[model samples]
Target: MSRLLSLSFFVLGALAQGTSPSYDYIIAGAGPAGIIVAERLAEAGVSVLLLERGNASTYASGGRSLVPWNITLTQYDVPGVRHYIKNSFADKSEYCTDTPGNAGCILGGGTMVNQLAYIPPQNVDFDDKWPVGWKWTDVASAAERVHSLNPGSTNPSADGVHYDQTSYNAFANFFSAQGYTSVDAISEPNSKHDVYSHAPYNVKNGLVAGPVMTYLPMAQAMSNFKLQLHTKVIRAVRNGSTVTGVEVEVDGQRQIISLNNGGRVILASGVFSTPRILFNSGIGPNEQLQIVAGSKATTNVTLPASSDWINLPVGQGIKDHIIVTLNFNTTESVDFLDTSYFIKPSSNITDPYSHGNGILTQGYQRFTFWTSNTTSDGSVRYFQGTCYASGQNYVSMKLYLTHGLTSSGALGITAAGNTVYTVDPYLNTAEDKYAIASFIDNLLVQTRKADSTLIYSGPSTDTGASLSKVYTGGSHWVATAKMGTDDGRVNNGTSVVDLNLKVYGTDNLFVVDASMHPDLPTGNLQATVQVAAEAAAVKILALPKQQSLSSSSSSSSSATSSISTSSSSTSQLSSVSTTSSTSAQLSSSASSTLVTLTTSASTSSTSSSTSSTSSTNTAQATNPTCPKSDGTTFTAKSGAVFLVECYVDRVGHDIAYVDVPTNRIADCVNKCDALPGCVDISMSGTACYMKGVVGEKIVNSKYIRGARRIS
Candidate 1:
């Protein structure tokens, strides 16, 4: 039977008699992606178990860190006091203890405790290095789905007012005079070059809003879905390449929750925790696997044998955006909001909180701007500056070297199973140092030009080691389990997961969180992370159930011994369909939900173009056969033409590849044009290899090459 049909039956059976302890999809971590993916899968009429290591956060989730003045709401529900939850001193309940760096462990994870800055990703963020199906054009609709629900507000107060104009005016004048266009940053996401705007946050009418508010509630209402809080997933139980289930810790007792016939396990536990889980499951570099085996505190738990270890670079290339702040004494009069606001709102703020409209609703930072610089080596480095009231008559701009930074660090698991950053991804490289110093020098020049009264309060020299030492981490970790076409199980391969978000060399094991991102995005990660999850769900749902469950039956043989014998009574079915026995049952529900719940915007289709050249290319593909082994020329929508070569393979300089549908030649041309630095493409059947520098070309009949006709 098909996996979908089997899972549907399991759900119906469980609802009637409560027979199986297995689930169709077991998602680890209750972050934005985890919630979104679980909701979509459950809406498809399949059983899903969403697990979170931490307890409830935010009042909706049972978090009761109530605001001192108002007894009804918690600090997590308030937009202004987001910093309170982030600081360990104020509240460490949401903090992840296993990871050395800061990470949220609560329900909704980072989304629940974040600054709520909802900066939409720039188009170049996807078009630059992401794989084909994840390109800007492909995922634009998915991003729109998130934006439509969480349309970030510039004026968050219910009264529709920019409460504090003192800091906004000071910085706005500085940036506007420097020729930076003042825009709604969230609306014009691509305007990252020279723009200044009021900080846009994922807030609505003075309340914090995110996936917890939007996606999680829909999932909670579904009968096929069950959210298990405080259930910590220790590691995946796998029989060689097939993952059967995850061994979770509930109330200090280890238990295995097996997958149904075709169930899948998706790890969305951020960058650090995802890698740690993989390592514990013996699915990482030999050194890490050895550490996991050697570090076990108890012999009761059985781990995957050494011979079955999947040696991949799981914790390599971990990244975080390095932040550097500059304190300036501005002549403009502005006072910082006092910390006492957390205990009791000031007389000026009390009226606004009562009316749900005031200065208290605004984010700590008021104005934000973005800039970029091209180094001598021709690499562009991106920078973002956020201005906030630091003190009386003082403002601090926290400058972030957001995108295009070459430096990266590593994450590793210690003998005690603690995850820590082995190397800090800061200005460790000379190139990064030069880029940061150059950006600061240029920024100082601009500050002087924009406002003579804006005086630098820090070091006289803001260029070298002195400046670099003052940098803090942005805490936006990503790429610990990097995603790409290259399978990491092979020698010298760097990718941990494939284009489908499935972990390489493993069946039914995937990652759908920040860990799957190949690199850091251009802005705050929440918006982009949510969009990627939506796109990933679409791709995962398109796959056949049998293909996903190829080794499910055989893997069960090894799973029985380590699997939990006790069945969990924690899940409660609400409104599951009792007679969902056909495979079409899942698809029918999934299609309707994808259109309405997941994808709010109309899907972008490529067949609408009227280019005669594309029509000619498609005419050749009418036979349903692969294109000619060799070719001559083609044209893209950008009016750029390409010279095609047959039987040639790209040796290096591979940015990413596109899996084209009908017109392989025409689709390759369009994909190359969409990618930023794609100079050439090597087409191999359905796969079109997009190249950045076009290093070395060799003859291989399995593929054809297309080099752009650079005028």
Candidate 2:
């Protein structure tokens, strides 16, 4: 075994890229890739270390900005709630919220903060865009594996949108009339195709559910798995010629953790964070590191030599979906965009969440995604816009720019404590803006054909417009770390990893996030990322020990490099990774719900109609507030810090809601706030929704299945 790696056994090491004495595998970042990778290794009986920077999202429910408020029509815009939204991500770019992007600070990562749509990319996309050995079938199998772990429902509404179908059909038909196709299911994204499915939501029955609730928990159950939450991996530690482990922080204390060379280290951090972490570890270009060493950050930092920068590309190719919104008033019955959704100046924050699910309910979330046939590569994205606040409404049509021409962006740190990520994701090529404008024009024309009312006569031709402005960027970012056959170029490059997702230089490190995409997909990135991660996990598990043969120097997994290594460490690590994460949990299913009941299936008498009577009346409550499965009141008065409202078959039970008092909600919200395991939480009513913790103790309530409240 490498001496440096061996030192990790007992040394109080804190270096970024030096080898430690021991550990089988070390995973960085806690999103889907990290979770699934850790789960697979732990299941296999390998000793694994899962490092996450964000706090665990196990207590509260849904949005952090909304957590401080109560959930009801009365306290909709409570002063604190409004202030919370205003102060949310205050340090981030104003457009971070203006455009819709999910950059969460939780254990589950983006999976926690996302809109929760589920999807996969077209089989041909992988087959065509990727290099040899990367086939659509392979990725499809991986996607199947992922879905098995985190399956979504085909049906969202119980009775299937009685009054809501009209709006959807109208919106879809209008587009179909102009050559668009109406798909009932979400399709695997294709750069040149269009299809639909019910938006594959991470949420089922109005609950947030994702990987942490599924893969990570199963891995956690394994004694071999050691999870380190709130541990931020600053950089990779290395010896003269061999890679070692990572330097991380826990509770403000820095520690150097090691993984034997025969042991594998995977960089599963997200696109934005992954490359940044790698660069900090001295895996990036020399020119960049020289600048870092000169900064105040260099005092405590120990950077590796420039040769460690490996010539292959890493975080250069960035891609994503760019959304172009069009707003219009429908002639037929339409979800009131300005009324229930966008709030007025006079509206108090008291009645935050409206009762009796409004248009935002009724499957108003029903939207479609398609990739254009354009030869140029652009992105579908949004800059925080008017419709993106804690109280903003009006769902905009997202124009996904699947295959943009631009390559990777610079992943570096700012003089400030925060990481500064700058990418010409769009306008990276002469054809960039043209492709976007062209696609938007096509989408507007087609969608207008679907429903003439979905229009917003732009006062300005600029694309960045939000509900308040035009010509703003969309939030569907992807392709920061691309997958390809060869290292294409310097600035504009081919990719960093292979079609099989093996990083160029490394032995076992693989990338499976949106950044690994050579080009953007046909639709939203979550579905495609789903397919990619699933495929990567399966392929990784199928390979034998040291299976990688084509690995280059960039991926951190090369075997021929000038470095001392040991197969014994690898073997020892293997001993801890023999079991699969979901083996015991998958006794037919990972989660067992109480047979979800639709409104039509209900034999019990519960009022299904909405009343004109105001919620402030608090008059004549109908449906009995059934006791929580524990036969306890789930409301604030009951003293429960967290309440499980909606549940998905995420793990052992279903996705749950966490309801607590406004005073104590933040603490409870912090508990589950940003983790992918949380689905949704309602305030004012003082309830937090929690996912992934549903247990066998649950009792199914016919419950308010739709967005409507349980009056």
lDDT top scorer:
1
Write the residue-wise lDDT of candidate 2 on 1-711 in tens digits: 221222231122123223324567788877777777676555444566777776555221111222322221111112112222223423221112211234655566766555555555556556656666566644543554455445554343333443234445445545555565645443333423444344445533222445654455445434445666567777777664345778887777778886654566677777776766655666554555555556645335566766565545555555554445555444545443333232232223122112212222122245454534445333332211112211122234544444433433455554332345555454555455566556566545543454464444444453432221233334455655677766533554557776556666655556666667665554445656666665565556455554222111112221111111111111111112112232311112122211111112111222332212222211122211211211111222222233333211122222544433221333333435445554323221123344444333221222211111121
In order, the Cα lDDT scores of the candidates are 0.69, 0.44
Model 1 per-residue lDDT at 573: 11
TM-score of each: 0.74, 0.61
* Per-residue lDDT of 7 in model 2: 25
Candidate 2 Cα errors over 4 Å, as ranges: 1-22, 58-102, 158-170, 187-198, 296-299, 307-309, 337-364, 369-371, 374-395, 404-409, 421-423, 442-451, 460-474, 487-494, 498-510, 542-711
| Model 1 misplacement above 4 A | 1-20, 86-90, 298-301, 446-451, 547-711
